[model samples]
Target: MARKKRIKIYSSNGKKALLLSPEEITIVKNDPSYEKNYEIEFNKGKQAFEVRNYYAIGFWKDLLFVLIGAFLSTIAIDYFISITGNAGLFPGGLGAIARFLSIIGANNITISASTLYFIVYFIMNIPLVIFGFIKIGWKFSTLTLIYSIISIFFDLILQNIPYINPNEFSLLIDYNLISSLPGAWGAIIWIFAFAIFGGMINGFSYSITYKGNASTGGSDWVTYYYSKKLNKDIGSLNIKINIFILFIVICLNTIILKTQHIDQTIKLSAIYNEYNSWNELINSDLGKALDPILSAEDKVSIDLFNSWKNLQTGNWNNEDWFNISKYISSSSEYDSYYTSTLVWKMKFKWIIGPSLFASLTLIITQGLTVNRLYPKNKILNLFISTNKINEVQQYLFSVGYTNNIFIWRTVASKKNAWNDQEQDLIMISMPLLYFNKIEDYLIKIDEDMIINIIGSKAVKGKNFSYTFDNELREKALTEEFMNNGKLMKKIESNTIIKTHKKMKKNGVSIQNEV
Candidate 1:
């Protein structure tokens, strides 16, 4: 019988190699059969490399730009809205229609105007998503969905948070806090802060999504699509689309606000009618059932009213007149009316004041910028927290980038814990990849290991230990750790020599090796 041939199996992580059964070896290595097997492995390696470099790198870099740029832009936008009121800055074209509706009392016209606003917003946003699909391909549709969900969640949070009306809390401070300039300024600051924070979230989200070979499902797709269709650059297209939408949004908002005011007026009219009906019921004959039992003063007034009516029509000096005057003085009707009126006045302020402040603030916070707010000199106050760095790394990982390195900072040594003579040091280094770029490949730091790259012959690992902290732009292989360098080198050399001898024994040319 012929001797059995052994086969080898490789781990996906390239950590180890194992022996396969003789039959398996024959199926994999037999002339025509092996060719197919080799091709599959080569294709897998090529795909992995492409994803690692292009998609992964693109995500991390984009995220870095967003984190740095978005917040500032948001703050700037908020500031611009502050000095100017929403009335003028917001799109007023819709307001013009709402005004016409109020004058003619056509309810349906106002409703139509409001409905048009949502329709326009959706139409504008859809084009952007289509463009993104065209630019990056359908593989990134999930990105748009994720971003849409996030945007909705953020809007919901803002909506649910109750507005703080200063007039309601007037008893505590006993001041008119709502309409004052201070109150308006505080609201402006709040708007700026929220804008900055929200902008950061949106920007960072886009960066991460792209890194994952996806996009934030929206106008981004439209941008990409149009760029390709027009043969224009994608980045320029994106900028133009964003700016155009911003202009449209402002115009639309003004129109909506005006229409909203008209709607409020109609609502207020309905409320007034309801209140009047209830008031009439309170004065009816059966209204006595709702009132408390008459006290001494109320009974006196009732008796006077009956006595006065009984008096002659022209009698001006009768006992009934004296009784009526006394009874009026005895009643607390004046006090009751005064208290109710005061309460309504205060409540009105509580209702309207805060809204005005909020609107004013929103308008002002729309113009600040990142570079303007967070100048280079302000770095010391930034804290530069470790958590921030971790956040950045986590964002990178989420986008499918490998976490091969973790960068952090420590306190300078020699101040408190270390000796006076010793100085502290901070270190940053890149990790090495030791596998055959595809399968099992030794990665000893000192020993030379060959890396098998696609479309190229194997290359010996290059030393890169001292590359960092110098002018080195990229990491190489040789700086890796080796267990007994000399021994490893000898083992690798001998193994290769033995393999060559075996090949020669089989009458194969050594020159065709690898």
Candidate 2:
């Protein structure tokens, strides 16, 4: 018998591998099969060593895309708030930032809620972009900063534009026209038209910014960093972060209400309304029947009823009611008769609207990215029978698992036969989104095929991550061009030239392939 001899080989990392015999080493040096294995190993190493360029495209085009996305997001925010009455519908962290700013200057300056919201939003983004710089990259951080600044100006411009002012636009619609509709129709319209549409618009803006390797700042930065770090779904992480922020905002709002004496004003308004109701009751037939039995000179009831009736009829609308001497001397009466009568009603729709909007927006956007957000690649491994392997592999490739496949033949002991059976075990790494389709395909090929699904927190090789389908993008562009042919025609030349130059210069690779 010939003695077995081993030839040691060293990996690029300097780790020695006892892999081949003397004859195997000779084959490895000259055989095509060995060359193919070497190429695969070399490519795997290259993937680890190659520096990933975050800004794969030029800064100018990316800046334009980020700006457009930011502008659309601002529009969505304004429209959502205007239509929903601010009941807490501002998306993401803007509401909490706005409320915090308001609390900072509750006494000194009187700023419009809309103006304050945008101001706080822009200011808070300054620190947030720093995190983007550290976690993401320079290009991403710079684009986010630009987006924040441009969006602030864009929001201000839209607020001044009377024709597109969300408040004015919503008011122009006649709710009375839809009054004959079902009671729930109003709610349905508000949710579907304002909430759902606004959420989708915001999601589109986010997706666009993400495609350009940028973010819109605020909770976006938080979500991005933590999602990468924790290897969790971006949407799930966003919900947790926003919920915590929302809780803080609610606490701060309660404190503001207490400190500003707004709660007292609300109580006073309720009391004033009650006084008017009593006055009307006294004037009714029931009161007339009871008046005879009541004690004479009931000053408390008389004063309240008389004061309320006088205010209702405008008998106390004179300057004498504003006189300092009367105010000081009859302060208690003055407060009940005039102070409480003054309207100091607070609209909570602003608070509630933004909260709802932020929550819903996170849910929609996260749902869209969940399947692709994992850091590690999920794979479906199969110990498929050799006879059905080709059919199974082709079916999977057609569905979207185009690469990352391996196969090997092995002998298996037969239960009651003299000969052993040959079986082929196939392995494939695929995106979780295609799991169901692959499973269904496999069932058609062999119902008893051995299968195992394994999830990883990190994947190192070529990744075919889920991305937006080109068919959808093409359809959207076609519809837009058809709807506004003249507008598209005017910009078509410039758009094509710019796009071609950018793609060429940056060596931009398209992710989605037919």
Candidate 3:
């Protein structure tokens, strides 16, 4: 009789092999005849054998997810990253360099902000793809390559929008919500809002692609690769990158202040919304130039002058200039510049303030998100002090924690060590897969057993050593014991372990791997 039940299985070791571009999956039920004989056969031809019990890597679901994630990444890159990096320039980095190159490309060759970003970013991902292939696996690297190509295709389509400018699309939606507030608050909110949105979408984009067995490329590749070599959280590595970008932002702004700061006055100026300015700029001779804080029907508010905007064209100056700029206090020299006509206006300094807040917001949000979704693939350390040590120890070993166990006789501390009876202290470190099953069994054996479980951030044993740092970038692909660690094998007793869900995020103590 054919059985309808399906059991999940996979060849973890074979997955890393070169022949499997994507692993193959098949369903096989329990059988007895095939087990007694060796399955492989060779006779000067391709070998054939009954794979009575076999499994392959599950890549179909992740492949579909990667396709969908590629589209989402397109949205994140085109809408938020392009808008914030090209238009605002607060959290400047390689994108700013692209925007600057686009500005000079205005002579005879005009490249849109989106196009330039694609060119710059894609060139950087080639090596990362190779690294992924070598370190991660052929399957993961192939999926990432597919995801990157699909996202690039989507971007190519979006870049064809009439304006070919990312901010031009954002300009279609006016952002007067908080920027309309009085004093420096408007400027502060303006940059903060963009940074928050940009950082969040970017985070979600990377995480989603990660779940799809891919990445948003660039820093995602570098962060994960180094996260292993350095033994650190991927989010923390990203924080370092953002902080470095902040330094770049400051340096670039300093360059602007020193080289291009204007001390002159032109005709009268009216304060137009930043959106209106981008709208007018995208259609002008300098239409493709993403640096457009001064390209509107009239002048933008003093507070909206981000560091990248050249002040000379319509820099507000002259004695009649409003004195409202003094209301804002700025420690950076880039904040305010005196005009030849004796006019003083706040530079708006959207650079430093917004970059700082965006960095902080990203650090917190990304950290929390990773912790919730991808707690490290860890080995849990069980510390047990019990009067019924023999029963607990036997049950623990029977439940599959047979390796790396230590026992010591100990006495009660608070009850007066000399007078109290001694009990054995049992310690074992094993994968989280067997944790709940063993814990439940221990509880049944001795309700009074005192147990403490501490998750290890890394693990190195006789045969294996790996750190499945559950960051936005990795999967628990190397959880070795999940397959051969006794619970998976049929035992005389019918005690079965269920599939484990994600680990708890909020409350858990994690110790260093030993």
Q: Output the number of the lDDT-best candidate.
A: 2
Q: So what's the TM-score on candidate 2? A: 0.44
Q: At residue 53, give the lDDT of candidate 2.
A: 22
Better of 1 and 3 by lDDT: 3
* Residue 68 alpha-carbon offset, candidate 1, angstroms: 10
Worst 10 residues of 2 by lDDT: 320-329
Query: Largest TM-score belongs to which candidate?
Result: 3
Of 2 and 3, the candidate ahead on lDDT is 2
Q: TM-scores of the models, in the given order?
A: 0.30, 0.44, 0.46
| Candidate 2: residue 115 lDDT (0-100) | 54
Residues 87-139 of candidate 3 have per-residue lDDT tens digits of 24332344344434443443336655655556655666788888888876565
User: Tens digit of lDDT per residue, candidate 1, span 1-514?
Assistant: 9765544433454344445455543433443433554455444544444445545545454444343333222222222221122322221122222222332332345422222322333344565556554554443443444344343333333324455222122212222222123223453344344334434433443443443434443445655455435433355444445444444444343343432221122222222222223244235332232233222336445765454444324344445544433332233332232223333433343233333333323222321221233221121101122323444443323322321343345443344764433222212222121111112211222122222223212222333221111111111111211233653333333333334444456675323322
Q: What is the lDDT, from 0 to 100, of the residue 276 in candidate 3?
A: 36
For model 1, give the 10-residue run with minimal summed lDDT. 376-385
Error of 1 at 495 (Å): 26
Task: Flag the better candidate by TM-score, 1 or 3.
Answer: 3
CA shift of 41, model 2, Å: 32
Give the CA lDDT, 0 to 100, for residue 77 in model 3: 56
Candidate 1's TM-score: 0.30
Q: What lDDT score is found at residue 507 in candidate 1?
A: 70
